[model samples]
Target: MALVIEGEERISAPVDKVWAALNDPAVLKEAIPGCQKLEMKSPTEMAATVVLKIGPIKATFQGEVTLKNLNPPNGYTIEGEGKGGIAGFAKGGADVTLAADGDNATILKYAAKADVGGKIAQLGSRLIESTSKKLAGQFFSTFGEKVGG
Candidate 1:
């Protein structure tokens, strides 16, 4: 299965602050709804564990996430690959852009693409797309609250 998601969010914080929040493992761990762990191995590399449930199917995925194409207070791209044992695997990336809105505000936009294989692909595209959107919505809602607070 292949899926793409694109959206924008307005944050009540500066671009630099938003960028910092994005890079902080603690913030990520808190913001990702099903994330179990996020360990930063270096400035641009990290390992993560996420548990996802789609209807009757549940899977735990372990992955390495990388941040690249970074431009401070502007934008960056993140890519990751997750293996879900027999359930199969997923690989994806997102391009995130941040624009200053005011002294303490920023607008963020993201374009994401993902590919899934194995048992997951059997779930059908509509199901996968809906689930992905739900997860993305949850992630951003949590992130916005955290960053704005």
Candidate 2:
């Protein structure tokens, strides 16, 4: 199954600050729901371990996340593909953009696309899509709050 989600939020910080925070491993770890570990492999790559639950199914996913289309204080694309053993596998990417709102605030926008396959897909396509959207919402809201404050 495939799904897409889009959203935006305002952060009460300057564009540079917001951009730095978004690229920070610790910040990403905290912003990503159920993210247990995030190890920066290089400037644009990270290894992540995350545990997610969808209704009665629970899975731990291991993945490599890469940042692309870099433009300082502007935006970038983040993409990852994770394996969940027998449960399934997921691959997704998000394009995020940042714009300065005056000199003290920034507006963040993103559009994400996700796809899944295997047992999880067969049983929970709808659930997965809804859950993905919910998680993205939660992540961005928390990200904005954390950066803004």
TM-score of each: 0.97, 0.97
lDDT of each: 0.90, 0.92
The CA lDDT at 65 in model 1 is 97
Number of backbone collisions per candidate: 0, 0
lDDT of 2 by residue, 25-51 (tens): 999899999999999999999999999
Q: After superposition, how far is residue 39 of candidate 1 from its true place, in Å?
A: 0.3
| Most TM-score-accurate candidate | 1
Q: Model 1, 48-105: lDDT tens per residue?
A: 9999986567999999999999998698999999999988898999999999887998
Question: Model 1 off-target regions past 4 Å?
Answer: none
Rate residue 111 of model 2 by lDDT.
98
